[model samples]
Target: MTPTSALLSTRPWPLLLLLTLLLPGLVQAQQPTAVIAARATLSSWSDPLESLGTLRADESVTLSATVTDIVRELNFRDGDTVEAGRLLVRLADDEAQADLRAAQALRDERRNAVNRLAQLQSRNLAPRADVEDARAQLRQVEAEIQALEARLADYRIQAPFDGRVGFRNVSLGTLVTPGTELVTLDKLDVMKLDFTLPEVVLGQLAEGLSLTATSPAFPNAVFAGEIASIGSRVDPVSRSVTVRAELDNPELRLRPGMLMNVVVQRAPRNALVIPESALIPQGQRQYVLVLDEDDDYRVARREIGIGARRAGEVEVLEGLAEHDLVVAHGTERVRDGQTTRLLGILDDDTSIPELLRRGRDQAEANG
Candidate 1:
C-alpha cells in the first residue's frame, strides 16, 4: 500500500462506514454530509504528453593540454566567463623560446645560401645540381622551423570557444603533462532536454513542436523549447521513442543536469471537465458521485477519456456535459441513488481567471 493508503488504513472504521454508506438506505435519512461540489466545465482539451526530462548543455568541453611543461600562469579563476581564443592557462616556455630562436637562425642562414646560389645559377657559374640542392635544403629547414613555431604557441593555452569555465582542478606551479585536465567549459545559452514518448505518440510528434517545462528553482516560470530530434527506432521493451528539445536559456539559469517535468501540448480542442477528487475508481469501473436535477447524489458510472490536468482541475471525456454538477468530496460516504444536497466545491472552476487573481491578491496581502 502507498504511504497515503497506509495512513488512511490506520482506521478500519472508514472502510466500514463506506460499506454501510454504499448499502441502500443504510445511513439515516436525517444525516447530512459536509461535502464539496463543483459545477462541470467545458475546456479546450489539450492533448499534452508529459514526461520527466533532464536538461543538458548544448556544448561542453574538457580543456586540456597539447604540450607538457611546468605551470606558469592561470589566466582565469574558477567560474569565469571566457571568449573564444581568450588566454586560459600558460606553461613555462623557456625551452620552447630557445628552440624557436635556434630554428630562426638556421632558417635565416639557409635563406641566404639559397639566395647566393640562385644568383650564381643565373650567371651559369654554379652547378645546376648545387642550386637544386640549396633549394631542397632551404625548404626542409623552413618546414622544420614552422613546426617548432607551432609547438611553441601551444605552451599558452587559450579557450576554444565562448563559454563559462568551471572550477580549476589543478593549481599554478604544478607540473602537468600533455592531456592534463585544466578546466571544463560549457555553453549555457541554450540547453537540450531529453525525454521519451510512447510509440503511439510518435505518429503525432514532429520537428519544431512546442514544449513547456518547469523546475523547482523557478516554480512559476515556464521554459519553452522546440523539438530538436526524435529517435527513429523505438525501444522494444518500453515501446517508447527518445525525444530531444532545444531550449533558449537566455538567463543562463536553466543549467545543465537539472531534473524537471516536461509538458508537450498539442492543439487545443473541446473536452468535459470535473474535479479529479470526484472521480472514484471501483475495481476497473470509474465512477463520480454527481447531483442530478432532482438534488439526488448517485454513484454515476463514467467512461472517462482523460486529458490534461491544470490548476487543480481534471479534463474528462465521454458521458458528461458542461451543465453537469459533480460531488467534489465526501464520495467515500455516498451510494448509487443516495439523496444529497449541494455542498461548497473545493475545486470549483467557475470564474477561474478571477479566482486565480483573487488568490494572488490574498497571498500578497497575507505576505
Candidate 2:
C-alpha cells in the first residue's frame, strides 16, 4: 500500500472511478442468486405398464329377424335405448294371425266336444272310448296353437337385453329374411377395454387391478377402470395375454371400437422423489444441487441414483433424503458452495416457469 497509496493519492480521480465501477460487482457478489428449489419428498410411486387397447361395449349384439316378413311397423327410432323384451320391430303377421285364430276356433270346438263327451259319459250316455278320443283331439289342437304362437314370435324383433340401438337398418315395408341384419345393439352403461400385455407380466395381471385409459376423442378426459378378467390362454405367436377391464360410462361418452392408451400401475412403494428438472446428467451419472440450509443456504453438487421417472418426477433411489431441498431452476448458473435465494418451492402441481414468474413479480414488488 505504501507505493500504491502514493500513486493513488496522485491520481485519486482514477481510483475513485475504478471503485465506482467495482462496487456494484462487489455488492452483487455478496448477494445470493435467486433459484427455485424443491424438497425431496417421500411419495407413493408405482411402475406403470403402458399398452394400446381397444374399447368395446360391455355387451354387443346384432339384432336380426328369424323369419321372412315385411316390416309392418317400426316400433323404435334410430339410437333408441330399449329394455329387455321390448319390441323394436313388428313384421307383417296378418296371415299368421288368421291361422292362429282358426287354430283357436278349432281348439274351442274340441274343448266343447270333450266337455260334452265327458258330461254324456258321466250320465252313461257316451262311450269311454269317444271321451278319450275327444280329449286327445283337444290336446292336439292346443299343441298346434303353441306351434303357431312360436312361429308368430319369430316374425317380430325384440331386444334381448337393455341397450342402445344403432342406426335403423330396415324401414317399414322392408322384407327381411332369417339372419338379415336389422340393427346393432350395444349395452353402453359399462365399456370393456381389452389390451394385451407381454407374458412376462402375467404374474402381475389380476382381476380387480386398477387401470387408467385415455382416448384421443376426449383429450382432457381420463377413464378409470378395473381389470375384469385375464384370458385363459396366452397367444402363442405374440407371447401376450389378453386383459379385459370394465369402465363405467355413465355419460355415454365412450363408444365401441375406440382406440385407447392404457396404463396399468404395479408395484406401488414409498420412495424419495424430486422434480425431474433438478437432475443434471454428467457423463453417465445424474447430479443435483442440494441446498445446505445450516451453512447459510449454500448449494452442493450431489450424485444421485435415479429409478423410474414419471410425470416430470424422478424417483430417487439414493443420495437424497426426505425434506432435502434441491435446486430445481437456475441450476446451470449456480456453482458449488454458492448461496442461493429461494424464490419459490416447486411441487408436482407447480411448474418451473410459473415459479420463476412468481419470483420475478415478488422481486418487483419488493423493489
Give the winner by TM-score: 2
Model 2 lDDT per residue over 1-367, tens place: 6998888778978888999999999997888999989999999888989999998998999978898889998888888899999988889999999999999999999999999999999999999999999999999999999999999998878999999999997888898899999889999999999999999999977788888999989999999998999999999999999999999999999999999999987776899999899999999999999999888679999999999999889999999999999998889989998988988888758877898899889888987
User: lDDT of each model, Cα atoms only?
Assistant: 0.80, 0.92
Q: Largest lDDT belongs to which candidate?
A: 2
For each of the candidates, the C-alpha root-mean-square deviation to the true structure, in angstroms, is 15.2, 3.6
Model 2 residue 174 CA deviation (Å) reads 2.5
Candidate 2, superposed: residue stretches over 4 Å from native: 1-17, 112-136, 292-295, 335-337
Report model 1's TM-score to 2 decimal places.
0.64
Candidate 1, 1-367: lDDT as tens digits: 8999988877898888888877756554555554556778776666688999999888999988877788898899888888999989888999888888988898889889989988998999898899889889889888988988888778888888888999998888888998988899999899999999999888898898888999999999999998999997999999999999999988899888998799987665677787777778767756776676564554454555555677767877666777777777667876677666544444534543454456567658966
Clashing residue pairs for model 2:
none
Model 1 bad stretches (over 4 Å): 1-45, 267-367
